[model samples]
Each structure stands twice: as C-alpha cells, then as structure tokens.
Target chain A: MTENNEYAVECEGLGRVYRSRSLLGQSRETVALQDLNLQIPKGTVFGVLGPNGAGKTTTIRILSTLLSATTGTARVLGYDVVKEGREVRKNIGIILGGDRGFYGRLTGKENLRYFAALNHIKPRDTDRIIDDSLAQAGLADQQKTLVEQYSRGMKQRLHVARGLLTDPGVVFMDEPTLGLDPLGAQELRQRIPALVGQGKTVLLTTHYMFEADSLCSRIAIINKGKLVALGTPAEIKRNFSSIGVIELTLNQTRPSLQEELTGLDGVKRATTSADGVYQKLTVHVVAGADLSDKIAEVVGKDHIENMVARDPTLEEAYLEIID
Target chain B: MRNFFVQAYLSYRGLFLWLNWTAYISNVVLRPILMLLMFALVGKFAADSDAAQAYMIGMIGYAIPVILLGGILQSFVYERVFGTISFIYSSPGSRVAVFFSRGVLHFPNSILACALSFLFGWLVLSLDLSTLNWWTMIVSVLLTAAACTAFALFLGNFTMMLGEFFNLYNAAMGLFLAMTGVIIPIASLPWFFGDLANGIPLTHGLVALRGAFAGMDIGAVRDELLLEALVGLGYAIAGIVVYMLVERDARARSSLERSPA
Candidate 1:
C-alpha cells in the first residue's frame, strides 16, 4: 500500500532553521529546511535521499513529532504532527539523529524495559515486550550486558528494536547505517525492510545512494531546503537519463583533434583521458541527424576503436539532476 | 505518578552511584582506618570511644551534602547533555511523575546520594551509627536529597556540560558549609549572617538533617521541617517550569523555525 493514500506521513512546506554565531562571531541564520513538501505511503519504505545537511534529519524530526514545523503542516498516520502530537507519536516509531534515545548504563533488557514502561505497556506485558525486543534486536544473548559495552553496531540494532517497541503503523530511521562496519551496515539495510514486510510503513533518510536504491520504494531528495526530486528510483533516473556515448582507445596525443572534434556537427563534447591512450566523446544530435555515420566516415578508423554507444547510468543521471 | 518515578528511579538508581563510587567512593572505604590511626596518635582524639565516635558522626554530617550534589544531580546533567533525556522525552507517559518521570528526579537523587554518602562516611570514620534513630535519619536524608536535587536542577539550567555541575556544586557547597552547621553552627555566626542562613532551604533542611545525626526526634522539629519540604518542592516545580521553557527553546525544532522564537 502506497503511504500516499494510506498516508503514513504527509508534509506541506515543513521547515527548520538554526541561528548560530559564525567563525567571525557574526550571527547567522542557517535554514536547515524550508518550504519542503513530502509524502510517505503506508507499508512502503519511503526514503529521504540527500547529501549530508540536506535537511534529512530536520525532516525526519518533524515527521516523527520530535519536532514541530515552523511554517508548514505535517501529519503522521492521519494525526496532525503539530496539534495532535500524542496521537502522531502513537502511530509512528522513530530513531532520529541516530542513537539519541538510549541510556548507556542500562542493559539491553533494562533499556527496553525502561522505554516500554515510558511507552505505557502494562507491567505484565512489559516482560513479554522486553523479551521479544531483545530477541528482535539480536541482543538476546547479550541482553544482560550494559549498553555502554555494546559496539556501535549493537547500539544501532537496539535502536531499531526500540523503534519497533510500540508496534506503530509507521517507523522512521535516520541515517540507518551511518557509522557501521560494512557487514553491520549491510545487516541494517536488510533489517529495515523486514518491518515493511509485516505491513508497517517506514520513512527513512540516508546519505548513501546504494542504500536508497536497494531499500526505498520511492525517494524524495531535498537540496538546500527545497525538494529537488521526488519519484521512484527508476522513474527519477529516467527523468535525467541520457544515451549515445562513443568510447575510444587511441595511441597518439592528438591535441589538434580537440578543435576538430569540438567543431564537428555530429559531436557534442570531447575530453581526453588521463592514460593519453583513451578519449571519451559524447554527442547529442538534432533528432534527424545521424552521428554514428559521421564518426565512422570523418574520424577514419586510425584513432577510434573500442567504440560503443550506451545509455547513461543512474549515477550519471543523479549527478546531472543535481548539477 | 507512581509509575513515572518508579521508571525514573529504577532507570537511574544504581547506575550513577556505581559510576561515581566504583571510581573513588568505595576506594576511600579504608580512609576511616587511616583516620583512626591518627586519632590514636593525637591526644585530643581521646582514648574514650566517644571522641572517635564523634569524629565519625561529624564526618557523616559533612559528607551528606557533598554526595547529594555530586552523585545524583550531576548524573541527571549527564543524562540530558548526553541525549538520554530524549529517550525519556519521546515516551507517552507523564514527565512529571516526579522522581520516576525524571521531571524533578534530580532533587531526590541528590538527597538520596547524600544519605548513602553519609552512611559510607559513618562506616569509614568508625562512627557509632548503631544507636541512631533509623526512622528519623531516613527522613532527614530524604529531605536533604530533595533540597539538593532542586538546587542542582536549578543550576543545571544555566549550562550544558557536567563541568557546569561542578561549578554549581562548588558554589553551593561553599554556601552550604556556613549554613548547614556542617563547620560551625549558624547560631554562632553574627545576626546578619545567621538571618541569611535561616532563610535558606539548606538551613532548614540541615536543622532536620543534623538532628538525625544527634539521634533526636526529627518530626518534632515541625515548622522548620514543613518549611524546608515546601521550599524543596517549590524549587523543584519552579525549576521544572524554567527547564520546560528553556528546553523548549533548546529543542527549537521546526516549530522554532516557522516561529523563530
């Protein structure tokens, strides 16, 4: 179920700003987010993909109801995050700004118990929740060990367990794998989607593109407090997709071809590679024009070989979209 | 309300004391033995056990305020500055379950730590706590904790670091030394100085706290006892109100962004 209609989270112009003194001791207003609109469909893992400081944390903060929107309105699970905050908190589970919600001295079992009590689980039910949570967190064996002793990866796992403590309809994980070892990072990437498999909606934010590609059902990329792109990974890639690349391997230094290739009617752009034995040239032609024929006839078999035409990658499209 | 403090107390109870004590609290357990050696060497200490016993009782009275300030209230500061406060804040239950909710748990922590430290001091100094009125002493210890927790919580509002806790601790202790009759009795001081001490919460608190050390009837010190409890509770509530306002600004969130408050 798409969270848009089932609507786990919806935002209309959410924003956050911080006022800080600059290096020169000048007061400056840094707008972390501004006029940003967003929607996360229920049961889907919606990702907020952005470079660091793209307001991902700020956005997650608002939707999780840990934050109140300065200007716009946001709702989580049909509850207005600002006005009906208690209900919003009831519907969504959040692990925002990474590992901010844990006590170091409490053992894994104790930590879960404390959080469960605060979440209002009845005394008898709390024991079951703690048992289930320690197991779910994969900290079952180490449940008796204090949180301070747990490695960074283990703390993150506990954070996920705590997020699921309420069994809410929607969940939020910010930088889900921010400071994990490769194995741990990969482990978290898999663990996140399992919540969705059980029909829980997830809203996640990450700086890793691969994480988004591997996990998100749809993504919204915010740049400088604005929504730069919003769509499915495939759909977004297609929006900026490009084709027609001519790759070449050459032996000689041809500085003169720079002008000839640049001025050519079929060639769009040309640049020499570091090896001096390779050149990559791309051409965007007027639809009716034939550039392949021009390359074969004009460039003359001497310098060009390993020539290939291919569609651009999502990586390239993402760069082009942002640039 | 009961559950809130239960969570807060249980959440923080042993961890903080263990944290401070494991480092030096217990390591100094032998200090009283060392002091006994000195007392044996000094003629003024007396061969009579009462002199050595008085030293222990006095030590307990002195350590009460120090442990109260450092052990609990400081830990609360760490809990917040380190971000564990957010964990508690996210929960649905009352933040005001007093001690359990951690809304004003600091005052209680300080008070309880004071009692614990005094007990430690008693054993170390070879004091005669054996004849002490257990019930009255317990009440005094709790009152001392409540008062100090309020003080620490009040000071915590001004800074974000545990170092700030020390700053507040030192300032309060200096003021405390003259008031609690920990050093000299406030009654011995000149009238102006005595009046300042009389009005302070610690003054009223120590009146009860010191009475417990004397093995006296604590509840009978009625008016001063009630006044101190009211003052501690008042400070706690007022401190919480200030914290709520200041912390709201600190949280800022998007609400602050749109409103710029």
Candidate 2:
C-alpha cells in the first residue's frame, strides 16, 4: 500500500451527458466530457483548460464522486469513482461548482465545522482542525464572521478553507479564483502553490490561460467534449505554433494590392480590414524559414507603418488545438 | 448502525429544536383558543345544552390531528426547501433512513404540543373526565395522533413532488379547519357533507375522538376508527413510495455537479 505509483486521478474514455427539459417539455442532451483519458500524477497541480460548457466542471464532478460517468471508468486515488466512492470522498476535498457554498445563516467557521462533523471527524478536534484550516487559507482572523457579510474575496478564501478542512490527499478546485479582483486572484495564485508544498495534489480548472500556465505543472485543453491537448504549457505552445501571425497596418497599400501580395512567395495569406488599408496576415513558413525580407519586399517598406509580429502564446496554442 | 444512530439522533434533535419555533407554539395555542371562542359564540346563539358542552369537552381531540399533522407536514416541507434533503441524499446513508428519520424528527414536538394543548382545552371548558367514555376518548386521542402523523407523510411526499415545500405547508394549513371533523362529527351531518367528511382521514380520527368523547356504541363507531387507522397507514405508505420514486428521479436528473472553469 506504500506509494510507488500514486495517481491522484485517472480516467479512461470518461464522458457525461447532461440532459435538460426543452421549452416544449422534451429532453435535450449536451455531451459534457467525451472519451477523455487523462492522468494526474500524485502531488502535482493539474490544470484543465476550456471555454464555457467545455466539460471542465463535469470532469471535476466525476473525479470528486459528485457525478457518475455516462460511460468509461474514472478512479481517484486508486478507488473507483462509482464503486468505491466513499473511500474516494474520504481522501479528496472538493470545492464544487465555483463558490456554491456556505449556508447564508451560518458563520464561516460554523459551516466548515458542520461539514467536518458530517465527515465524522471527532467533535473534540473540531476547533483545532477549523483553526488550522482557516489559518492555512489565510482566513484565520475573520473565521467568526457570517458568510453573507464576507466580501467576494473573503468568501473565496473561506471556500478554500472549507476544501482544506479535511487535510485530504487531493483537492479539486473548480474555478477557484473566478469573480475575483486582480489582487485577490494574485493572492490566491500565491496560496495554491503553498498547498503543493505540503505534498497535496490539486486539480484546478480555469479559462484563464495565465492561471494555467503560471500555476499548473501540466495542462489539458478540452473543447466540444473532447480533450484536444495535454502536456506542459510550454511544450503545447512550441508544438502547435505552425503559423507566424503578424499585424501589418498599412498607410498606403490598397485592398487589391494586399490581395495580390497574399500570392507572393513566403506570404501564406493576407486578410485586410473592411476599410481596406490595414490587414493582419499569417505566414506559413518552412520550418526555420526566415521570410522577413520577402514579406517586406511584397509590401513596400514605405507602405508598412506598423509591422507587429505577435508571438503565439498558450492561448494561440489552445486555439490551434481546438480549431 | 452508526449512520442509523446519527440519523436518528439528528431527527430527534430536529423535533426538539422545532419545539422552539414561534409559529409552532402560536399555532398550537391559537387553534384551541379559536375553537373555544367559536363555541362560546355559537352556544349563546343556539340554545345551550349538555351536548353542546360535550362538544366543547370533545374539541380537545380536534387539536391532536392538527397538532400532529401540522408538526409532521411543516417540517417535511421546510427541510425539503432548505436543501437539507439534498444534503442528506448525498450522504452515505440509505434513503429510507433519511425519510424515516424525518418522521422521527417531527414526532416529539407534535406529541408534546398536542398533549399540552388538549390539557389546556380542558382548563377552558371545565369538562368532567370521570366518564369511561371520556377515558376511551383519551386513548383514542393517542391513537389518532399517530394516525394524523402518518397521514402527513403524504403531504411531505407531495411537497417534494412539486419541488416546493412551503406551498404544501400552506395548502395543508389552509384545509385544516375544514378537512378534519374537529368542529362537527361527520355522522351527525346530513348526506354529502357526511360523505366528504368520511372521505378525509381527519374525518375518521375526529370521529374516533368524538366517539370516545360521547361513548357512542362501539359496534356503530368501530368502522370509522378502523378506517382512520387503515387510511392513515395507507396514505403514509403512499407518501413513502412517492418520496422514494422522486428520490431516484432527482438523483438521475442532477446537473448540480457542474464545476465552472
């Protein structure tokens, strides 16, 4: 039972279909996670990246045992999500569905203790465990305050405290920093890495690329119910950058001239703005191909006012995978 | 067994806690006082008689059905509304355990408020309890209390089915003054009024209480008492069945597991 091959999460072709009643009272189905096989190493921060309705929440819910998979197998900490759910729940802490927490009537400290009591943690240890969790979440000073009184940032911090109350081996933080200001988001960004220092694995999902690239050791990008890319953020960016996109704001070149320039050697494609003077174009170059001189030759040097070469970021890499 | 004890303890605690609610206390006192006021006014209008005095003596039993059913019905609706039922469902416990636990939760306050309210009615009307018929009526009170509580299981199930809790509470409450034969015995009424009264579970329980109140012949009253108990139990079972069916559907329909990223 010692930890040789500890995977915090493992899924093989896991999928979920969410059905809702249509306007006509019939059912409509939306595929959430589709045939997704992913593994998160123990003690690593794994980020799931996607746009809205990309199934990030569905995947997290399955891993946390809040939902059953429509098909395929999912295991968390070596326990089957469906069969051994209790064991899975015992070892994992989940902050479900971004900020859907805390009874409005109860104080922050009370809410955490109630969940802890439900988890069957001994009553005598309640105060100590709660204090420790709040301290860890940086909410120790304000533990006594009612949740309804807390600001948005304070509530997010309280949710983190609640998630960490069990000191479980893993935490599934779904949109943990959503609806937060830059300062609060930054502070949370700092706090998450500290959990990794405690050897706790975190499965985080976010639409924000900076959060994924900055916080996660590995990232998975999903779109339309399929996992499109999975690897280190840097590796993803380097691998998928096929076209170099440059925005050339022209002072003199006409629409027809820009169209003609697109057929020039080394100039892969040109797209002009509707007014027809300025255009943003992507050039497909041979690997290691340098076509700056040829591009400059096609669009006369005098005509190009602002030649800005936008280096592709993770967002671009993600778009390339999903597109 | 641990989960069972925990559930039972929570239910027991729930009942005791409900005893502190202002609504429960006010309703318990209000029902009997209003009945007393209605009687004092009506008795003065019509010729006063021992039988009318007996009706006042008997109205105590009316509170039993209201107290017990009110207690059971409201708690079920409230818990469902507060998302407590959802939390209980997600817990690693049997659905039967949670359902039964809720019944246990409403019983204590229902029983206590009922016993106290019946006693308080005796203070207002000053009816002599030496009659064996009255003693039988007391037994009938206890039995009918259980019957009303069981009947409330249906309202609780109905509350879940509609996906709203308090509206059921209000509906149960709104029908209380009319449905239960607290005011007049169904057998005393003529034709369709009697039929409508006989059809309701409250009608049977009220009849049994009234029979106990006046020493109506056992052979004549046995049918109504038996119907009360049987119908109450039947409705309770139906309620549980409805709750169980909806529980399965609710779990299947759950989309709350979504996490925003």
List TM-scores for all candidates, in order: 0.77, 0.73
Output the number of the lDDT-best candidate: 2
Q: Model 1: residues >4 Å from true position, as ranges?
A: A1-5, A22-25, A97-101, A240-311, B1-6, B13-21, B24-59, B98-138, B153-164, B187-199, B209-220, B253-261
Q: What DockQ, on C-alphas, does every prediction get?
A: 0.39, 0.17
Give me the runs in candidate 2 sitting further than 4 Å from their true place: A1-5, A20-27, A97-100, A240-311, B1-116, B123-158, B170-181, B184-247, B255-261
Best by TM-score: 1
lDDT of each: 0.64, 0.67
Among all windows of ten consecutive residues in candidate 2 chain A, which has the lowest summed lDDT? A280-289
Query: Model 2 over residues A1-323: C-alpha lDDT tens digits?
Result: 22235788889989888788878999898898899998889889999988888999878867876667888988878888878877877788776434345554456787676566566666778789988888877778888786668887787777777777778888998898887778778887897888899988999998888888899999988888898888998877766545555566666655566566667765555556633654544444432446767777777888777776655568766765676
Each candidate's iRMS in angstroms? 2.8, 4.6
Residue range B1-261, candidate 2, lDDT tens digits? 454455555444443233555865576677655765566446546746564554554455555555656556655554544344444444444556556655664555555655665565567555544443755565566556666667677677665556444566666644554556565545566667767655556566666666665666555567777887787677768877877676555545552222212
